[model samples]
Target: MTVDTAVIATRLSETFVAEVTGLTISPEITSEFGRSIYEHYLDHKVLVFRRQDIDAGAFAGFGTIFGRPEEHHVVKLRHPEQPTLTYLSNQDELGRNKEMKTSGQGWHSDYSYKLVPGGATMLHGLEIPVAGGDTLFADAEAAFAALPEARKEFLRTLRVRHQYRWSPDRTDPWARWQYIGPEERKRTPEITHPLVRRHPDTGRESLFIQPRVIGSVIGIAEMAEAESTELIEELVAHITSAPYVYRHSWNPLDVVVWDNRCVLHSATTKDLDEKHVRRLLRLTTHGQPVTPSMPKVGYSRLSSR
Candidate 1:
């Protein structure tokens, strides 16, 4: 169902969801919309726009106003007309179902595994099935703010190890760089970052480390890994707690643009056996690497093939 762009513009609110209006064209309106998106991104980590009739190229055109879109070096499948648009789904064009886990199943920042992670991400839903496949986003800024004073103090001075190749189960070969290439593998297996980071634009402290990718807390006792892991897990739990998050149930023409720097997100499980297909075109925004003095943490450079 198409929505009125004017109505959406008038009623948009910071506390609740708002559908962005206007045809996916017009240079003047698009520029204003891009700035609005940036402001909303800083205020609300998740923003959903419904009924945007955007093809891959059109979506890329809208995305370019915000920032240069980055190609998914690992996810080779992209729209032929728009190379910047990464096709995310469990089905192919011929109506045949492919494997699940097209990229969003886990709770993560877009490319936090990389030395230079993604800045923002735009996902336009082309196809969506019934009853499942909603995306959940957690506000890391809110999560960090809610931490207990003692816990915050402890985390402020710590650093954790992160790896691109790390996964919950050693099943997906694509999850590892060895299967991809040595050049790609160079950035895999490990890097270190602060437990707490100050946002480059906002200068607000946030929980920087994520689970699984973080091997252990640096300079801590080896026997303390279990304790450290438990502590981090609790912190993540606090971050994902309800009221600090929003879930977006999709419609075919829905488009979502999110800031990766301050939010963590994941996709809900869907019925893969019923020939259900969920197709989305995604473009990522590039971000500068977190600096040392900002947090005084050690980070080793790994290869990105």
Candidate 2:
């Protein structure tokens, strides 16, 4: 359980993931040390730092080492003292789980509909469910690499539109929970991003499909809506295949950082116990707006959202 205070990165799974240890992360940080921590994040798309019983200030500090920590558009869940961290808690007002916790019920890259979708999200586990409530992540890069050459070429030319609002068929409790203010709606609107995203820093091509929030795909003028839906279904299935996936079981003192640009994650909670609740503090690092024109591979056919 206890380890040396010298920074170490240990691979957790066969896929691109590592368990980070031996570093004390705090608000007042050194750039030299932070850069080394970030290098591990770059090498491993997901990093699990365990037994880091740090406060909110320290969590936000670790987040900024990668980039500027962004406030959640959802203002209600934000920590009073720290805007950068959001409390993903399941308890209702009186410390009971009478309400549904919907922050990450389905697989998604955080704030993907935004013009500049967030980059890396770090979550510190304040409390976790014993039986379930694990978070699962899928590697888009590996999924794309496994695709057939013809399918890869076709996807490169396509664009997909993502919307933050729930679909018409989504009659779940989250339909009301996800509501934003009228003025806020203007700030967050449907945006089209390349189906195949080129990572801004690495320039690595990834199968960038946010299945839960996707409204539609453009650029395939001849494709019918029904066929497009089927295609998207297939893409989601392939991207989340077991080979490219890792399921993380949380420990109370564990903190996990996942790159939203390269990974898709979902919380796995089959059922919640009303007796106890799950809670976590999360900080997000914002990335640059995705440019419509991807010049790396010369694929730029897109439609206005």
Candidate 3:
């Protein structure tokens, strides 16, 4: 598709998504233009911008329109020139992907374990695979809306625990990949957030659970251990059903952005090996603190190895 003088947005799915075209993001982008894009983002939880061939810096700049771009916790994955942007590639320095595999295989909302979670996440597809490497998103807002009134009430009164590294005894592939040093672990402590999160901008409640990746409902005083575990498993199954899910296949130069507040996403490249390489440039925006004590840290210098 060719760039146009005006941007165009078309509904991708009624479940909730929009495709944006004809806009080129640059240093010259005006505030009005950025605000318009954000309006579309607030309306649709996911926005697919077609043919965005911008570099990492420009991609990071585009991410700022939604919120302040934040550096990834993984220091090695940070782009050299644009530190705010990170690489999600199945390749090493020598371009040999034989031993490399994709990350974020489990469904999760980015930075859900942090004191201040990520507001939104944008990915620019650079290298795409032939068959796999697709991304799946679940509509948390829709899933929460579909729940029974009694269940919703119960969920609203609950608080769930989230930690980047929850358990130390687990021996899984993700555990190896998600390993953090003592300092990094200290930076991301186990925090409790409302089971049902109300979006700051839209003021809509959504199921805020990270069943696979980060944490579980462990802090609710009223719920027992087995009961909380059962409740989390049941809700995860319900929230990820067909009606609330959207699978997105990648295309070269495509920019896909999703609201981290109300969406759960997972990478579908687990079965893929180095032979089928997939690479993406990712930038995440700063999110507001869900609790009173968790202050927003826009940009912080954390030495990580």
Candidate 4:
């Protein structure tokens, strides 16, 4: 079947995001429609496709339009038949959608801890809560662009370290969860990417820092731990401020995709409970470094190593 249809894109935010309508997704989506979605995705950091009632298999197929779908580090949460699709749910039995682990509560880019971070993360809402379960996104590009030229130049010269499950407060609940094992730790060691990362495809620069998994600036002899922490906090606050953010309140069957290189997203658990189940299928695609080369340092659980 020739799937020829025109997709209508309306701006959700002035420049940060857009909503694409008029295209129904399927495993056999035409290349032309897929290309149009990709173009919108690049132009706007986030694209929301309304009312896509597709299964895990079809969602996995739709993800290929962005790039090769990459398996999330959390293996158990992945769909049984479709390994590339992971469940972001508040339910235990993923099959039943009763409740389990709730992912993306923190403001961070997907897979930023890895040497090669994820390029894009797409989520398809299966079951949404009555009140909350909204996802918030910050436009890193806009945040960076808003900074003074002097500050931008300074950020460009620095590299920030990010580690898996590394939190400033060890008491933080996310750090307490021992989901990432020893071997997985070895696979995802401490890595450093430029503070101001230029999108490889777009050549646009964005502030890149995962506050939840962030560490100090590496290779800076003069910068102390306190100074590094202060800097990270400052930048994270700027990137996540209201001016750059777009809050997405999901409805069932809504498919939302965001650019990881230029967008920081966090999940809200406002009214999520046993009675109100919020379940979404998530897929992230493989990504190369924002810059050509980044230093892959060895493992270290401690904040400073």
TM-score of each candidate structure, all chains considered together: 0.79, 0.84, 0.85, 0.85
Candidate 4, residues 198-238, lDDT tens digits: the string is 77666677888756442212322246777887887788899
- What are the lDDT scores of the predictions, listed in order? 0.63, 0.72, 0.75, 0.75
Name the lDDT value of residue 134 in candidate 1: 87
Worst window of 10 by summed lDDT in candidate 1: 296-305
Please give, for residues 1-305, the per-residue lDDT of candidate 3 as tens digits: 12233556777765677788777667666354787777678767899987877777788888888898898655776888888888788767523243335546777888787778889999999998888889989888889888889988878888888777565345754563245577876776778888888777666678888664334223444577678777878888898888888888988988999999888888887787767878888899999876321223332321120
Question: What C-alpha lDDT, on a 0 to 100 scale, does residue 277 get in candidate 2?
Answer: 62
lDDT score for residue 197 of model 4: 80
Superposed model 1: Cα runs more than 4 Å off: 1-26, 93-102, 168-183, 187-189, 213-223, 291-305
Candidate 1 residue 188 Cα shift, in angstroms, is 2.4
Regions of model 4 farther than 4 Å from truth:
1-5, 28-30, 73-75, 94-100, 176-181, 213-222, 292-305
Estimate the Cα RMSD of every predicted model relative to the unseen true structure. Answer: 7.2, 5.9, 7.1, 7.5
